[model samples]
Target: MFYRIPSLGGLSPFVSLLSLALLAHNIDAASSGVINYGGDVPIGSKLVQVHVIYRHGDRNPKSPYPKSHYHDLKSWPGGWGELTDTGILQQIKLGILLKALYGPQNYGLLPEEFNVKIYKSVTTDVDRTIMSLIANQAGLWRSLKGKGIHEPDVQWNPTPFRVIADNKYDTIFGQNCSKAEKLVDMFRDERFEQLKNENLQLFQYAQENSGYEIMTHPTQICWLYDTLTVELLRKGIIPEWANALYPEPLESFLMEYLKAGSLTEEMRRLTGGPLLKTIITAMKNLTMGKDTIKMYAYSAHETSIYDVLAALCSPPKKPPGYTATLLFELFQYQNSFFLRILYRPGPDQTAFPMKIPGCGEQYICSLKKFEEITQHVLPKDLVAECTV
Candidate 1:
């Protein structure tokens, strides 16, 4: 839906996906201290906190396949797989929109002045994710900083983003489930065997054009799809032979493989449960006012979104796109707290409210109800749970 414009450096960025409806929006300021954002909010309730999880903006493909058209570095400004100038603009616009939708002068949801003590940001130590946090902060505050922070020439604020040094075994990402991995492995192997025979012709076609020495694994073909997709997103460099297979049988096959593990209760618990537990803990912290943070923004990957969604019993309908986001908000009404969730379908769209399954038909769920519904997937001991 979008293409990159390198010459503008994002000021007049190419009509990319992130700019569609977002750039033209002029959100009306809030009359009171509540942020409605087109959602039906109980009149007396006030937003207490928001927890955000978002994928990094558009970037070049990570894998460099054999005889690939995008092998040239000129096409990738920041080198392969790194966030591009286009992506930076996407994130900047996102921050601007977020501030407009939440800042005190606009929606009156967050504080007027920047308060470090009341906000927190974190990211995996990946280069793209870290850069996204910085770029997003630039838009969210627009050079507004603390009392003593300053720069000699640039109008900039230094926002501290804590980075997780190593997430290889982080339960919050649902990465430590050995049993779940084996189950998913078995499922994919079986599916792959059936698919291999069914799509022998496609396999032959990909083998000839995909550059992989072997087209045996489903993930390998998905990698080809990813490459072409990024190329199409950036410079439209995909060869005709490659384009023929993309976004079709390729995408359908990829989804089946990717979703195989998350289909079952035991799989979702061990594979996606840990992240849900982490979010539930944050909700509890806000309920107790234990942490002063009014918002916590996490710059992460698509898998993080999947973990939260699948564990919440709201598995995604498609691969989460670039800059796709999930927001978990807590509200206070008459001394009781409630939870509301929203999902942005794409970078250019406003997030629609989500009706979490088992939370009934309403968008808002009592904190107690929210906890009760998510309890099954929230593993008390991820390690022991993974032993299954």
Candidate 2:
């Protein structure tokens, strides 16, 4: 017998061991609760356009911890935070998956041929993300170019994608807010107490070894976690304490820090609300025929993923892994439009349709109801909200 537990996207988050054993043996397309990646269309609803936000692939640590051992720039050939070879491959894999799922033959969300007029992509002004987009495009083009298809003789052409400027604010990036800064300070103090009381030995060890500088901000330890994780990935040298307590309490602490940085209503408004506002505006524009683009893709960070999900009332339980994606699909049905949001946890994982809280158990939400339920999370005037 199989039991189900509540989870996002209508799939049970937890399953009994017997359920797992059953799932392992009886894998088929017809199984209830099983979502076929290519078969998620809502009844009688025709797909309209798709919007995607994905974290960059694996990379070296953006910054080293205090008294860090992995300081050599040569150690990371791509320099600080640049995409590694594995990162490129990861994005390429994602691109191929995108083509399989959204290309003309499947969901028909994207054009068969690469068309600047119908497709749009945006990324932050960062090297890893920029390269990841190019890599993903390469994967898509490769799929289009090979195997008894059109454009076999055509060499891969460059795809146009915009990059947000440093001083400007966009849907995926947060604007400056004194309130957010102060919240970070508050989170730092809170984490210090929690650590000192709960894991004092581990806390004191990481603190003394990593240096005091990293403890200045609540999110700084995440950098240290990054460094450690990269080393663990490479099978490089790591401290004994880290080997014992590295990913368990350390990862949890890092997640808490990330979540705490945007814990309050005002903090979420400044950090995550802009993206929701943008998405809503896009949906409204599509419903009104103002938007001609068929696909909108944002190549961004895990924080970007977190920002948007938190805005949607589903803050991530763990850090979004490399190539994690949030897909928002709009559909038209009988002169009305509805929405379907799915989360692909990793590059290789199947996309799970997210059943948004208060949006009911149904996977498809009408655009009008979506705008109504999401009003509390979408900021009215983002700039004004950020100021003072």
Best by lDDT: 1
Best by TM-score: 1
lDDT for every model? 0.72, 0.69
lDDT of 2 by residue, 1-388 (tens): 1123212343232111112211121223223232344424567778888888889988887866657676678677768888876677677666756665677666777766677867888887899998888777765544233532334233344678888754424444654455555776687678756665676566666777877453344345566788888777754677775666588767887777668656777777766777777777887997898988877888888877887788777888888888899888888989988888888776555668777777786777888999888788777766556554
**TM-score of structure candidate 2:** 0.82
Q: Which stretches of candidate 2 lie over 4 Å from their true place?
A: 1-41, 66-69, 142-155, 168-172, 175-179, 211-219
Candidate 2: worst 10 consecutive residues by lDDT? 14-23
* lDDT of candidate model 2 versus the reference: 0.69
Steric clashes per prediction: 0, 2
lDDT of residue 161 for candidate 1: 77
Model 2: pairs clashing at backbone N, Cα or C within 3 Å: 9-353, 9-355
Question: What tens-digit string does per-residue lDDT give for candidate 1 at 207-312?
Answer: 7887775356655777777788887887755787876787887778777776776777777777667766777788788788787787788888877787678777
Model 1 ranges off by over 4 Å: 1-39, 72-74, 145-153, 167-169, 176-182, 383-388
Cα misplacement distance, residue 131 of candidate 1 (Å): 1.4
What's each prediction's TM-score? Answer: 0.85, 0.82
Candidate 1 minimal-lDDT segment of 10 residues: 15-24
